[model samples]
Target: MAVLLHLDSSLFPLENSGSRQLTDAFRRTWQEAHPQGSVIYRDLAADRVPHLDAATVAADTLPPLRRQLIAEFEKADVVLIGAPMYNFTVPSTLKAWLDQIILAGRTFGEGVPASGKRVVVASSRGGSYRPGTPRAGFEFDTNYLEKVLGDALGLRVEVITRELTLAPVTPAMAALIPQAEESARQSLLRAAESAREHAALVS
Candidate 1:
């Protein structure tokens, strides 16, 4: 059976979270298609991984949590991530998780021949950062995730991001609420599409 590792890094309640909603959309469709497939869920906000330290970097052995994380990652045929942008970047918990995955000899090294795994990232940003916007290149979360999941880990990463997610409450962004809703709708569509595509490959 295909194994999917689903991760959520949202700091807010699920009902109020865009990234959570997007990832949930993909999981629902994917489970519908692959009835017997297994999903391993990890909520980073609730159970944050410890930040990497000098001991982790200097020693050949990994910490217990990191070892477990790496094992789960290695076993997953698909990885689904809900990354909520925080302070101009991905949540620190997410970063900690990624740090564990980018292992030296285990995940990558000479003769390792790339992971070639598939990952889907459902991301959300509170403000507008589309190209040509004043904060255009300020987006650090999705881009960093793409590079690490693709280049460093050798995974085929597909991303769907919803922006201006704070429109409901932010007075200044209230005018762009429609656009935010549209972005969310489009992201959900993309998530479903990608889930189907992944199901076809595995199932």
Candidate 2:
């Protein structure tokens, strides 16, 4: 049966997390298109995956949580990840989940199918960090994930980003509120479209 696997790493509660909210929008539409399909949900912030240690060296000997994560990825036709930019990079919790899934002998290796799965990355940024901006070079979340998911693992990856999340609350960014609202609307539109398009792959 077709399955959707989702990971949410936002530190804030789901009601207040932009990344989570975007992912939810995608999931809702996706489910409407495939109501009979199964769904797997993992909340990394509430139940963080442990960092790699001696016990995590081999795929066959992975801990229960790590093994479960990999198994879910293996069965998933669609994977949704909530990646809120933290410290200019992916949240450490999300990174930990990636480390567990990117096993050389399992998820990746010579002669393996180059990812039959579709991956959606819902990215949320607190500030405006696009190209040509003063801090453009510091934007790392989407770039890093694209390389790892698209280049490294060969999954079909689509990234939809919501920026300037702090504009309404940060005194310094109050001037950007209008732009932030537009960005949010555009991001939601793109995410919904993407979900509708890719929902066919698993439906």
Candidate 3:
């Protein structure tokens, strides 16, 4: 049975945000596909992870907490992250969580062969940032996530972004909300399906 780590960092719950709603839908679909698989869900909003300070950073090189966090990461075959873009970047809580899991010589060895894991990030944004759009240059969240997970940690990273540009109440905005929501739902389903397929392949 595959172990999946599901991390939710949205400040808002499913009732108010597209990110949480899509993540829930994806989880249901994934569960249906893999009935025997186990999922460990972590809500950063309800239980916050402490930010790494100077002391923590200094001790990170030889800390038991680092080992504990790495053990959790190694236990999971798949990692699913539901991240909401805040001010064009990841939430602080998610950043803190990342800091905890990304350890040198554990998650990745700096000078040795790269042997990291895989991660899928499902992100929600209030505006469109796809390439060729004016807002595309402002997409620091997805870019930062990919870079951090792939370059720094040596993890294979895949990203799916659900932009809610059309959710506003104005006439023009109201016309696009349904379309945006549908797009988001489809993206979530596709990502979950891909993860299931990848899990089967690896197994």
Candidate 4:
């Protein structure tokens, strides 16, 4: 049976969270494609994972939570993450989850167990961060994920981004609401398409 590990780190609910919306689209499509498949979900913001501490780092054996997280990650055919940009990066909750699963010899370094796994990231940002944009340099969320999850962990990373997410709520960005809506629409489409493709590939 195929498995999908879904993680949502949005502080807001599905209706209010752009990242959650995208990830929900992906998950729904994936489930439709694979009715018998399994989905392991984690609402990171609500049930936050503990941050890496000295005891965990210094422990000779992997902690129970770390082991469980790693097992789930390794078992998944596709990993979907809802990573809303908080201060230009992923939420601390998501980071904590990553820290737990990323073991040097196991998931990170040479002969990585998670190598070639597909990871889809639903990224939502308040402002535009495309190349040549004013705030392009501040686009750390996706870049950092690509670096850590793709380059380092050797996962096949796919990102679906909804930019200018604040336009609908922030008075200052009112003019870009249309663009933001369009971005969100396109991102949702991409999420569904990506999920379908992965479902087929996994099958």
The candidate maximizing TM-score is 4
Error of 1 at 102 (Å): 1.2
Alpha carbon lDDT of each predicted model: 0.90, 0.89, 0.77, 0.93
Top model number, lDDT: 4
**Candidate 2 RMSD computed on C-alpha atoms after optimal superposition onto the true structure:** 1.4
TM-score of each: 0.95, 0.95, 0.86, 0.97
lDDT of 1 by residue, 16-128 (tens): 99999999999999998888899999999999988888988888777788889999999999999999889889999999998887887678767678868999999999987
Model 3 segments more than 4 A misplaced: 60-65, 165-172
Clashes in each model (backbone N, CA, C under 3 Å)? 0, 0, 0, 0
Q: Mind giving the per-residue lDDT tens digits that candidate 3 earns over 1-203?
A: 87778888998878776667666766776777777888888898888878777787787364676566667677887778888899989999899888988766567656645555668788888777889978888888989999888887777787877887447655756877887768777877777676667567445
- Candidate 4 TM-score versus the reference: 0.97
Candidate 2 runs further than 4 Å off: 58-60
lDDT of candidate 2 at residue 144, scale 0 to 100:
99
- How do all the candidates rank in terms of TM-score, highest first? 4, 1, 2, 3
lDDT of 2: 0.89
Q: Please say which candidate is ahead in lDDT: 1 or 4.
A: 4
Winner of 1 and 4 under TM-score: 4
For residues 88-187, write the lDDT of model 2, one tens digit per residue.
Answer: 9999999988988898867887767797578999999999788889889998999999999988888999999999999989999999999999999999
Q: For each candidate, C-alpha RMSD in Å?
A: 1.2, 1.4, 2.4, 1.1
